[model samples]
Structures are given as C-alpha cells and as structure tokens.
Target: MVWLFAIATGLIVANLYYAQTLIGPISRATGLDPGAAGLIVTLTQIGYCLGLLFIVPLGDLLENRRLIVTALLTTAVALLAASMTSSAHLFLFAALCIGLGSVAAQIVVPFAAHLSRPETRGKTVGKVMSGLLMGIMLARPVASLVADAFSWHAIFVLSAATTAALALLLRARLPQRQPAGGMHYFELLGSMWQLLKTTPVLRRRAAYQACMFGAFSLFWTCVSLELTGPYFHISQTGVAIFALVGVAGAIASPIAGHRADQGKSRSTTAIALTLGAAAFAMPLLIHSSRLVDLGVLVLTSVVLDMGVSANLVTGQRAIFALPAEIRSRLNGLYMALFFMGGALGSSLGGWMFAAHGWTGVLWTGLCFPLIALCVFATE
Candidate 1:
C-alpha cells in the first residue's frame, strides 16, 4: 500500500516537470522570446502554489479518496489540453492548470502521513517521498527522451492517458478518510496564517526546504541548456542518460527518513545543507579535460540531488510529526513556500543563464543552500 502511494506520487508530480527539459524546443515552436522562456517553468510552479493554497486545504474538509481522484482527473484534462494547443498563450494556460491539478501529489503525501502509525511515520513518509523524489529526478530525462523520439506534445499526451488510468486505480484502492468535523472552507484557509504565526517549527522547516528546493530548481532549469551548449554539446538522448545516472540520489530518501526517526533530523539537515552548497562549487574547482568535466557534472548532479532529496524527507518528517488533524494544511503550507522558492529559482535561472552563462547559474545555485544554512543556524 505504501509502495502504491509512492508510485502514485511519482506519476502525479511528473506532470509539473515535463516542460523543463523541453523549454528550448517548446519556446521555439511557440515563438516565445528565448529570454522569457523560463516563465514556462515559473508559471507552472505558480499555478501549483495557487492550488496548494486553495485546493489542498480541502483535503482536511473532504473525503481523501474522492479529493485525490478529482485532482487527478483535472490533471488528465489539463495534460490533454496542453498536448493539443498550438498557441503559446493557450499552452501556457494549460500549463497553469497542469500545475494546479498536480497538487494531487501534495495531497497524497499528507494522506500517507495520516495513514501511518506514529512509531513508523517517518519511515512511511520517507518511503513515499522517495517516489516523489524519483518523479522529480526522472521527469527531466523522460521529457527529453519523449521529446526526442516524437514531439514534446507526445509526452503530455502519454501523461494524460496514464493519469486518467491511475485515477481509476486509486479510486478503487485508497482507503476512505474524512476529517472529524465540518470545517468551513474559508475558515480552513484563514487558520493557515495562525498556524504559520504560532508554529515556529513549521516556519523554520519550510524555510529550510524552500531554500534547498530553490537550488534544486535552479540547477535543473539550466542543466539541459548547459548540456546542449559548447561545454558538453550533448543531445536530448545524452541528457537523458545523465539524468538516469542521477537517480542514484533517490537512495538518500529512505536513509534520511530513518535518521529523522532516530531523532537526528537537525544534524541530518546540517549535513544536507553543506553537501548542497558544495555540489555547485565542485565544477569550478575541476577545470580539466572534457572527460573530467563530464565526470564532474555527473558527480555534481548526484551530490546536489542527494542533498536536496535528503533535506526534503528530513523536513517533511519533522513537519508531519505535528498535529494529525491539520496534516494536510501543514503539508500544503510547507510545500507552497517550498515551491515559491522554486518559482523564483526557475525565473532567475533562465535570466542568469542568458545573461551570464553557466558561471552565473552555478554561483546562484550555490548561494541558495548557503543562505539556507545561515537561516538554519539560528535554530
């Protein structure tokens, strides 16, 4: 059952990312200005933030199985709409809806947390989040490979089909969960602020994850462009292979969760932040042969990804240990802040890569974790 939740997470979250690797081609095909192309990723994340703010709170007010199914169905429709649209304006609109509906993935995470025993909660969230992290890591290569084999549109078409089918499987399999009372929707949204103001732990953990995720987004948003540029001169298929190798980082997810269960999240978080900051600096120190450069890039991806994945699970495990009744809203608040940083990172990545090239991108990515570490130091 946990594994199924994990698989569902990976599939649902993949919708938000298929556009990242295809940004160049999609922008060109749609006649968007190259300078503004990062908006493709940014707008999707903004849409996700919107959903996290509005729809995710309903998880606490509705039946979990039905809420999850509805969100997935919306995603399937959005994916289909995106695949068919020719106009850039219409496609961007569809992209927004895709992000909005993909909050189903966020809903599932808290639902998994709700289902687990307190004794095993960290392990369960960690295992489920491994799937989420896998989705994040694999979405890039899958997008590139599909775009290479057919068209970028085909990726959305396939996603639409798969999402629709998955909705049915989940509807049949997931246990029913309805929060105890009938809370008004507006009241639920209103209470998030109080929760935020009162809960210092939530604020700190969300901030830490936000900074790490910002770095994660910044690196990924520029990596495909970096690979295709003069440095490595790689094709989409080659980029796919690089992404495949980075999947090794997912191993850190469960391990980080175990550490959290052992009451070691604070130390784990410190290690994660340090590793994340160092991952970006590695390439600068390795000015050598193309072979060594390529090897260094691979190492950077693994180390950066490992740090990001570990921090994510650690932060989530910390937050999920809070009040069970508000698990959905807590997760929403945490992820909404996290992805806001991601949106900023994506926008900055596009602009930085255009203005200053790979050096700009690396320095900006490195700073994210360093800033987060400073923030974590106050704790």
Candidate 2:
C-alpha cells in the first residue's frame, strides 16, 4: 500500500514538471516570447497553489479515493489539451489546469499518513515522499529524452494516457477514507486560516520550506538555460543525463524521516538548511576547467536536492503529528505556501537568466536559502 501510494503520487506530480526542461522547445512551438517563458512553470505553480487552497481541503470532508481519482482524471484532460494546443494562450491555460489537478498527489500523501500507525507515520510519509521527490527529479530528464527522440508533444500525450490509467488503478486499489469532519465546504476552508494562525509549527516549517523551495526552483529553472547556452551548449540528451544527477538526493528523504521519528527534527532541519545554502556556493569555488565546472554543478544539484527533499519530509512529518482530523488542511496550507515560493523563484529565475546571465541567477538563488537559514535561526 505504501509503495502504491508512492508510485501514484510520483506519477501524478510528474505532470507539474514536464515542461521545466522543455522550456526552450515548448516556447518555440507555442510562439511564446522568450522573456515571458517563465510563465510556463510559474503559472502551473500558481494554479497548484490555488488548488492546494481550494481543492485539497476537500480531503478532510470527502472520500479520499474518489477525490484522488477525480483529480487525476481532470489532470489527464489538461495534459491532453496541452499536447494538442498550438496557441501559447491555450497551452498556458492547460499548464495551469495541469497544476490545479496535480494536487491529487497531495491528497494521496495525507491519506498515506492517515493509514499508518502513529509510531511509524513519519517513516511511512518519508517512504512515500521519496517517490514524490523521484518524480520531481526524473520529470525533467524524462521530458528531455522524450523531446529529443520524439516531439515535445509526445511527452504530454504519454503522460495523459498514463495518468488516466493510474486513476483507474488507484480507484480500484485504494481504500475509501471518508473524513469524519462534518463541516461545510466554506467552514472547512475557513478553518485552514485558523490552522495557519494558531499552529506555530505549521507557520515556521512552511516558511522554512518556502525559502528552501524558492532556491530549489530558481536553480532548476535557470540551470537548463545555462547548460544550453554557449558555456555548455548541451543537447537535450545531455541535459536529460545532467538531470539524472539529482536522483541521488532522493536518498535523504527516508533518512530525514527516520531522524524525525527519533526526535531529531530540529537538528535535521538545520543540516538541511545549511546544505541548501552551501550548494549555491560550490559553483563559485571551481573555475578551472569546463569539465570541472560541470562536475561542480552536478555536485550542487545533488546537495541542493538532498536539502529540499529532507526539509520537505521533516516539515510534513511535523505537521502530520498535529491533530489527525486537520492533517489534510495542514498539508494543503503547507504546500500552498512553499509552492507560491516556488512560483516566485521560477519567475525570477527566468528573468534573471535573460537579463543578467547564469552568474546573476546563482546569486539570486543563493538568497533564498540564506533567508531560510536566517528564519531557521529564529526557531
């Protein structure tokens, strides 16, 4: 069941990121202006934030299996729309819907938490999140490879088919979890604000992740542009291989979860934040050769991803330890906040790369984790 949830979450969330590496090809195909191309990633995240706010709370009021299946189907339709569209406007709208529907992955996550015993809940969430992180890490490379071999449109067509199939599989396999809360939709929505205001852990953890994720988003959004530019002139296939380096970071998810289970969340968080900041500094250290420079970037990807993955698991573990009935709401609020940060990061990253180049992007990305570390100090 844990593995099922992990795989489902991974497949579903991959929809949100298929365009990150294909920004160049997608922009050219859709006739989108280079300056505004960040919208491809940013609008999706904004749509995701809106869904996290409006849709995911339903997990606390509705049947989990039904909600997950419905959302996945909706995402399938959006993916198909994306594949078929030529107008930038239509494709961008489809991208937004893709983010909106991908919240199904968030629903599966809390359901996994709800099903686990209290003693092992952190470990369970960690294991499931490993799949989610892998989806995030792999989406770029997979998209790159597919685009290199076929057209970029083929990737979306493939994802749509897989998502629809996964929806059917989850509906058949997942246990029905009808939340006990009797609040109306509006009332349930209202309570999320109170949760944000009242829960100090939720706020602090959310803020920490917001900054970490901002840095993560910024680095990834610009890194492709950097690699494909004159400095590296990497082909799509090479970019795909470069993306595979981050998969090593997924190892940190379960380790962080185990430490959280051992009552070491604070120290784990500190390490994670430190790692996030250190990753940006690495690229600056080595300027000797193009080969060495690429190696440093590879190391940076692993370290940065490890920090984001570890911090995310620890934060979720902390929030899930709160009242059971509010688990979905807490998760919703948590994700919405950080993903808003992600949106901001990606948007800024694109503009920074265009106006000031990779050096500018790196310096700007560095600020995100530095801010996070400062916030962590207050805790």
Among all windows of 10 consecutive residues in model 1, the one with the lowest summed lDDT is 174-183
lDDT score for residue 223 of model 1? 90
Per-residue lDDT over 130-217 for candidate 1, one digit per residue giving the tens place of the 0 to 100 score: 9998998899899999999999999999999999999999999998998884679999999999999998988998898888889988
The lDDT for every candidate, in the order shown, is: 0.92, 0.95
What local lDDT does model 2 show for residue 79?
A: 98
Clashing pairs in 1: none
TM-score of each model, paired residue for residue: 0.99, 0.99
Error of 2 at 300 (Å): 0.5
Query: What local lDDT score does residue 124 receive in model 2, on the 0 to 100 scale?
Result: 99
